[model samples]
Target: MITSPIWLPATLMAGATQAWRTAVQRRVGKTLSINAAGLVRYLYGIPFALILLGGYQLLFPAPFPVLGRLFLPFCLAGGLAQIIATNLLIMAFGHRNFVVGTAYSKTEAVQGAILSFLLMGERLSTLTCAGIGCGVAGVMLLSTGGKRMGPMDFLRALGQPAAITGIASGFFFALTAIGIRRATQEVGGGDPIHAALIVLSVTVLLQTLLQGGYLALREPGEMRKVFTSWRVSGQVGFLSAMGSACWFTGFATAPVALVRIVGQIEVAFTMAFGHFYLGERMARSEAMGLMLVACGVVLALLGAL
Candidate 1:
């Protein structure tokens, strides 16, 4: 039987790997436009994803699983949403620092709960809902950059470009999560790892084509940059593909909301990356907000159990 413990570790690892990948991708952003930097995750990752998928299939030598009725639509929608979401996030990065920008995007867990409910008909229990509430509150806290804002100020801040892009990024990422989960289930109920790999391979391929085609026409020079910096881009691709594989496996086994809530650990990992590697520090309010985020993650996991 699949247990929370089994999938929980995958979610955590995905989060950690994703934080690193985003950091690398963000650096890549400095050289390219938001669209191109966002595209790097999929474009470079395609080769590595193909290699992993091919290796798995060769080792197993199993017949391909039948795709379900909803598979194509789900996979395509998820892939497209991810492309848009990534661009929005890179835009947020341009407006804010890395840690704060990531914290803004961390609103995905709550947004995931809502999207999972609406699209997948997944229902959250009272405890799970409460955990989501805590998480959303924490996201708001982090979004404020630790400033003590009254209601009017909070509402005003939400109207800002950075906040709008950040929230929009979260909403679309939630869609990606739901769509990917549905796609994973449609692949078959047998081996989740295999199912995840199939979905990941297909989705990454589609994203590569979509983004690559766009860049080819609109930003050829940036496309050249993506290739010229293969050393760092390769690391980003490897980490992104592996992290996404873990996330897809977790989605296949767990509820999307639960998986996303658990994925909140990414914020902490991002903070650590910021502090140690980037020499960045958070304000007291930011620290307190992150603490709330930690509490929400713990509560959500306990509720899941």
Candidate 2:
């Protein structure tokens, strides 16, 4: 199971694409409507899942009984909490000063690795542990810009509220990965396959309802925009769905800690896509940073794959 690197990288790539797409919406001065975004986040699975779900479903139509029943609620809470974290990121993006906050979030791999060990009984080999450490340093380096600041500088720049919110948001995403994996295990009673599908669907449903409710109350009229212009917003929605689905599948099949750590490949995906499609350029320092990040990923993959 650990040798399967395909879905893990795919999930990372999707994350990059999602961030880039979200940045596009920011450029248009009309971010994705909350409801539309929610739908995208939940139903995004539909585009890819549309064809695959049928086959995946046929593979595992039976229930896991206790497995599916136990982790369902945790999965539900995770889905809803994701919306809250999204809201925070959207707000931070609007503030235009969340660069550091975003970088701070890259440390989520560490958090997930630790939690995976503690809660899921996942153990890492020395190589894997070193790989994870390199991964942390590499991502932190990739996120850091030259001569900007040191440890104290970073600490001083982020106020308590921004720091708290960013850390909380990062933790929520890490937790989401763990929760999905936990749910999948529960669904493993009769058939792990069916359990995975049920967990994904249930999480999606809960996420949609919660996000939809919030949009109805607060951004009541913005729903019209989602349909009015389909290109940008639609892309974001679709990508969101694809990313979540990929992540769900990866978590279902592998150890949570491994999946989360290897998932850092998203940064590279974003950089590559940004260069080709968006004309974003990286300095030599930035490129070197990416190389280190890549090395970390390679290390993680060696142990994992």
Candidate 3:
């Protein structure tokens, strides 16, 4: 069994930084196209990711791990999935407020659990399953816009554009998580942190190439805007790198399902940022939903014990 104290703090940091990065991405989307906005994180984050990997190497003085044949494939798959997932997420944001859009995507936790089990043969404890259940329920409630609704009405709500895009985002994000974990596992020797950082750097670089190349061919004008809007895009890049480093650390150190379950705390951080930073009003039902997500986090952590 994989166990590490680093996973908890790393997941927490990932959640916090991701929330901030996503919110900033939403802002960047206002001026840029969906694909352009999505590119901001990867294209701008390359430098930060490389700097982080270099710093870690200098500090630890570990030999680089040998890359297995699967490493490049995993990075490509994970990077591409993340690019699609992020674009879908940004699209979802257009259909709803940041908090609700993100809440819907929190379904990634449950989806990650299922994908991890089927693809990687990872299993969750009953308590962890229960926690994932609670988180999904809370996310469902949040999708209702805090209004009381019948079962059928709630079901219909799930069919909304925002819900569809958000759920699709969740599915791809789950794939991304599994890919990252598997890629990290393919690394031979070296510190797990070093392995994770290497995977992160490679994944980010690949994503930059793929997404940047697409923008260059399809929308050459947006490429200029991407560089011109560096003021805000730069922040998104830095936060994305920081958040991804932590997420890769968590994935390297624990089961992807567990890491993602704890990472559901990002919803709470998203809600806080939406309300305070973005001046968005919170509904009572949203608060209730957040409470359920928090309880789920606690239960998941307990199950990890």
Tens digits of lDDT, candidate 2, 1-305: 45344556555765676566555544433456534554454544444444455567666554335654668677886676677666555554444333333544556777888877887778876766777787777655555443355898756645555555655666777777777777777764544445555676677667767766666678767655545656665566566655666677677777776776677666666566545655656556557666766777778778864
- The best candidate by TM-score is 3
The lDDT of each candidate is 0.85, 0.62, 0.92
| Model 2 misplaced stretches (Cα beyond 4 Å) | 1-29, 32-39, 43-51, 58-67, 95-103, 158-166, 189-194
**Sort by TM-score, best first: what order?**
3, 1, 2
Candidate 3 whole-model C-alpha lDDT, 0 to 1: 0.92
Who wins the lDDT comparison? 3
Candidate numbers sorted by lDDT from highest down: 3, 1, 2
Of the pair 2 and 3, which is ahead by TM-score?
Answer: 3
lDDT of 2 at 297: 72
Error of 1 at 32 (Å): 0.8
- Give TM per candidate: 0.95, 0.80, 0.99
**Model 3 C-alpha lDDT per residue in residues 1-305, reported as the tens digit of each score:** 46578989999999999999998888999999998999999988999999999999898886788999999999899999999999999999999999989988889999999999999999988998999999888888887777899999888988999999999999999999999998998898847788889999999999989999999999999999999999999999999999999999999999999999999999989988998888888899998998899989999999989
lDDT of candidate 1? Answer: 0.85
